[model samples]
Target: MLMERYMRVSQAYDKQVYTEDGIYLGKVEEALIQDNSRIYGWQVRLENPKIKEALRGKGIIVPHTLVRAIGDIMIIARVSIKKEE
Candidate 1:
């Protein structure tokens, strides 16, 4: 017999997040929802030491489109963030 793993929104909180390039980005601080059924985005609390200087005092919002996988940790695609003017 085989079992399947199912994800729950509640379990996402505090889960570690990483990039496909192997960058330990941060932990899942919060999640956004749309229409009360779809996940809109993820608010990741930046914590990686490698990019600390660039991301200091900034929280990353990973859009659902960028999310690659959701298992032990969240895996997101490599993306460039543009500052809003």
Candidate 2:
């Protein structure tokens, strides 16, 4: 479902997050907000097995600008996979 309006941050907790291409990234662990009271991003816990290994102990931070939609799940614009050197 398309979100009609802004939602409370509390409503977003535990929601599964995915890339536009359908790769499961993780769940919404926390929301990042600006001092002006605007949400700027989210702190997503790594859940995908492959990403978990690459991320090590680091958490994923998705920028709000990349967010495509919000509903039962949050669909984000596809993120480029960065290969480790």
The number of the candidate with the highest TM-score is 2
lDDT of each: 0.78, 0.80
Across 4-63, the per-residue lDDT of candidate 1 in tens digits comes to 467788899988988898888779888899999999988887787656557655567888
- Over 6-76, each residue of candidate 2 has an lDDT whose tens digit, in order, gives 77898999999999999997888889899968898888877898887876744678888888989899988
**Candidate 2: C-alpha RMSD after superposition:** 3.7
Clash totals in order? 0, 0
Candidate 1 pairs with clashing backbones: none
> Which segments of model 2 are wrong by more than 4 Å?
1-3, 80-85
- Candidate 1 lDDT for residue 43: 86
List TM-score per model, in order: 0.82, 0.82
- lDDT for 53 in candidate 1 is 54
